[model samples]
Target: MQQSLSRGSSPLALLMRGVSRLNLYLAGFSAFVLLAATAAVFCEILSRLFFGKSLVWVVELSGYSLLYMTFLGAPYLLEKNRHVAIDIVTEHLPPRLQMPLAFLVALFGAAICLYAAWYGLAVTLDQFQYGSRETTVLAPRSYLLTWVFPLGMVLLSIQFVAQAVACLKR
Candidate 1:
């Protein structure tokens, strides 16, 4: 029997290394956003409790932080397969079918993410076309930042495909 043993990627190692660096950068950015969100929440809580003044923008910033963190971390999370899953059925499945089933689930999840990303991109574009802005103070360009959703989802989709390929090879 000829066994095809998967080995190191000498040809694409450079590309993989670059991608790893990018993922690290994204993870760092997400961590920074999370820290900023925590600080904003803390300051908002303190201000509201002690001075009877609220940081209205804090709420919006917190929302942005949440979105950034979620989107930025998605690719890395998928690469690691760290998302929570109900493994009872998968675990009981025979060894031969496990990879296929997992790949199907991942493909389904990728499709859903892709659809959400498409809508997000469309909405963001519409906002850009209309020059949409928040009603509150600071009035940041809401639509420009909205493109992050589609960009992140695209990265996640690629990660899902790579993961599926890895599983099939195993």
Candidate 2:
């Protein structure tokens, strides 16, 4: 009985640990993105003003980096349940109502993210199929840049499912 109990609890504990670690990883990645963006911006300024030339590539690259950073950070935010909520209604609701409302919200959010991932994947494939490339310097495939959206959203959707499960179990 004791062994069974421990084994049964272990999976949940492991899942929780993984989720916590994922949040830390996401936060770290976000910080790195921020630093990269800052550096890129600084370099852009230096190249444009001091060198009397344009660092047009830096602007484009940094813009994409910013977008990636925002998406990558989203899953971490979801895990922490740190997203902004109006709370006007939730704060006033009873615990019972709150629980159901939270579940429904999570379900809806997960569904939306799942759909986004599907659509993003399709769009990325299309770009890849067409050999689309950026108009600016480097001219890397546009599909590579577009991939971040689907991947990040999928991860976020998974995180929300985990959160919803935890909430229901509680």
Top TM-score hit: 1
Off by over 4 Å in 1: 1-13
Alpha carbon lDDT at 125, candidate 2: 98
What's the C-alpha lDDT at position 15 in model 1? 51
Residue-pair clash count for candidate 1? 0
Model 2 lDDT on a 0 to 1 scale = 0.77
Q: Candidate 1 at residue 13, lDDT?
A: 52
Indicate the TM-score of model 2.
Answer: 0.82
Task: List the global CA lDDT of all models.
Answer: 0.76, 0.77
After superposition on all CA atoms, how large is the RMSD of candidate 1? 4.2
**Model 1 accuracy (lDDT, Cα):** 0.76
What would the per-residue lDDT of candidate 1 be over residues 86-143, giving only the tens digit for each residue? 8999899999899899889778777887888888899999999999997767788878
The parts of candidate 2 lying over 4 Å away from their true place are 1-23
The weakest ten consecutive residues by lDDT in model 1 span 1-10
TM-score of each model, paired residue for residue: 0.83, 0.82
Looking at model 2, the pairs that clash are none
